[model samples]
Target: MNGDWLAEGRAELAAERILDAVRMLFVEKGASAVGMAEVAETAGCSRATLYRYFDNRQALYVAFAGREARQLIERVWLNRSINSEAGRADQLLDAIASVLAEVRKTPHLAVWFEPANSGIVAQLSNSSDVIDAIGAGFVAGYRPALTDSAARLLGQWMIRVVVSLLTLPGGGEDEERAMLRNFVMPFLLDDTTTIE
Candidate 1:
């Protein structure tokens, strides 16, 4: 039995505890309501210790959110959207759908991405590995000339649009997906696709 395993396990457990505290506070109150002190208190760590792990509240929230986005983009979106040999345009639309589908299912994550939170999140966005991936996914093969601003607009728009769809009280899944497809294709589908 390797004692190194026990050391690594303790590190993992502490990281998870901190993240759990962040999630609980941010969910119960908006991201604005949670601060480093609150997180430290909830996580059973001293403020100095929490700061040792994460520099600040925005750092903690952004890091956690970015990590979640990366996993969702890779596991759920990339896996579901990109076929073995798909072109970039098809991959882009499918990736958009996959991300929105995830946001629809996980509203709490959506809260962290809200415009109200954007002032802080936007600052952290400059360093986001996940947003970088999402942006790169948009720029690849589909539209090499696409501007970064447009990609950002489209990404946030997709999330807002999907939230509207899910808030509709009641609707059949097929019908909703079809409705989403019809509404989204014009803007998101490749300009090369002929609309009938």
Candidate 2:
């Protein structure tokens, strides 16, 4: 039993090290452009070992993205000061703005949003269940009355909005905030309305 626990610990450590190494590569070369051989070399692991941890580049990307997305969500919530007295729309705008600022400042994350890489980012964002859960969690904070399916749908929409802004930002931060406030907040504020 002790040996099994030790082996598991070691495996987790090796996987984390590989992920750390790949993060730097993602920063330098952009996420979509990175290849498996490059990840193995950067991670100081044999291709066999890298493959053992991640079946393919897509799996590796999903793992890395899931980890980063969870961390980003935690940071955004931790740093934000939510005023209960503020209107829901105002509060939602603040949350969106905070998330955007966090992604923009994080190097590995920002690289995912670069024009050349945004397509891959969008695909992953749309497909990843981890991301969907994160979005649902965000929506739940604001609309606790929503059913799980409704929250998940709204969460996905919110994520799509964020990705759209990241892929093609507005004229500036003020403009982006204005767009969110004007366009996104209304739909969000009405929890009774069905999406699609």
Best by lDDT: 2
lDDT to native, each model: 0.62, 0.84
lDDT of 1 by residue, 1-196 (tens): 1223235448667666788888788778777678888887888877777776788776787678776667676766555533344464455556555666676567566665565665655555566656665755643434444566655555555544554554442366566656656677556656463223
- Candidate 1: clashing pairs of residues: none
lDDT for model 2: 0.84
lDDT of 2 at 143: 77
Across 7-84, the per-residue lDDT of candidate 2 in tens digits comes to 655888888878898899998888888999998888877787889899988889888988899899888875554446
Which of the numbered candidates is closest to the native, going by highest TM-score?
2
Q: Model 2 off-target regions past 4 Å?
A: 1-6, 78-85
